[model samples]
Target: MKHQKELYKEAMTVLKATSRTFFIPITFLEKELKTTVGTAYLCMRAIDEIEDDEKLPNTIKAELLHATSQLLLKPFDRNAYLKLLEPYRHQLPEVTLRLSDWLALCPEGIRNTVASSTSEMADGMAKWASKGWHIQTKEDLDEYTYYVAGLVGTMLSDIWLWGAGIKTDRELAIGYGRGLQAVNILRNQSEDKERGVQFIPDGWTRNDLFQYAEENLAKADQYNKSISKRSILMFCKIPLALAHKTLDTMRKGNNKMTRKEVEQTVEEITSE
Candidate 1:
């Protein structure tokens, strides 16, 4: 058998490179797992790249995900999406390079699991983009976030459960994922607006959103504290702070969410 240590090291190298590159704090979590935390991070990182990528038209993005998923059913062809990413090669995270190497060496089972899940995440994204307009209500936002991020919550909970010391508070952990994503949506209101995406409900205006943001931040704090894993806690904390800041700004009638606010939030959380 190939060494588990080697697999883990590759995974963590990818994890470290991906998280820092993407401004995520999730990697501070490696110590809690008995097995491949590295693979988990790499898999999740790839998902993050897709979700955060603002370049492609919605349909193309959906097609790319469909292709990625289909390729995963077989062996992953590294070159398949390599070209798509090449123009922005300098922008690729150091972790993705390590992830490529790790993908080659990973246990078939791990690779299969990660690959399959990535496909599902992509499929869900595709379905969301084209058909989302059919969803004409606030209830739609709940389902949409669940498909995009709440599912990440479930996936993450499963990962933590597979590891040691997870202390699974199933509802609580998933709440962190859902709440965190919601906070990001709230914070990125302007950017999303530019893309013609509206995450919050039409019924909820600025003041109502402020109250909702405050509510979610509190949920994040509660969930992070309820969970035993320090890594999960660290990951949860950033959005909690962002929600906190956004809520505060809303109180002052600061309607615009700027890059400066995001940078300030990032700095504040990392320093802690």
Candidate 2:
């Protein structure tokens, strides 16, 4: 658990330093949701690493995924899993290096909480990614994202118990995670399609990505309204703002449009 704190710090540091777009929104959730975000990122990144590893043989990828599923029941398999990532280990120095940076900014107690939580998250993620390629239905997508995103929602609730910072509405917190995952689903629609993965619910399509984006924003309404404190609401506005920006683009822009002019239009809308 102590070591997990170190790993958690490293995860956040890497994300904070190398990722500009993710920095601000994450900061808003810093105290409570920070651990939630860090652990979620590690889990999501593991899936991304496996799926995005173009250099690995397909069988190895499948095997790794399978191993990951086994690991969910035994999280210490992280060391073994990390070993499997040997080929790309050199490229991952920053995941550790950045931890040092984030550690410097963290208070001791919060750091420990972040660490234990993140370690569990990393292990759970490994377990999930091991089966990440098994998406056969929309329900599977929800379960998967719940493993990847909604779990973070529950964690956000846990972190909130640490202080009286926000209204801490559980429904809204759940909404936050769903909305964020919805944003992720929409943004990665093309890439996900290329890989035979679909995170949107049934009856949705690339053609309806924008419509689904609206669904995401609609999903967020409870969360946005759940904030009773204006100050906290203003601070919490970051993720919602990003969700709105993402959904607004989805509404006005054609995700399937590949023409330079059309893509540019989408990009322009997304930029807002």
Top lDDT: which candidate number? 1
All models: lDDT? 0.59, 0.54
TM-score of 2: 0.62
lDDT of 1 by residue, 6-98 (tens): 766656655555554333554455544423445554665564565456665667656655655576667767786676556555654655433
Compared with the true structure, what per-residue lDDT tens digits does model 2 show for residues 1-272?
35766656666666776554555556555454565555445444554455456565556655655554444433234466566666666654444323333433344444444444444544444554455445556566555555556556655555555544554666556556666776777777778778765566566666554454456456566665755644345445655665666566666774422345444443453454
TM-scores for every candidate against the unseen true structure: 0.68, 0.62
The 10-residue segment with the lowest total lDDT in model 1: 31-40
Question: For model 2, what is the error of residue 9's alpha carbon versus the real structure, in angstroms, after optimal superposition?
Answer: 11
Q: What is the overall TM-score of model 1 with all chains considered together? A: 0.68
Provide the lowest-lDDT 10-residue window in model 2: 96-105
* Model 1 stretches astray by more than 4 angstroms: 1-27, 31-39, 73-113, 132-135, 215-218, 229-242, 253-272
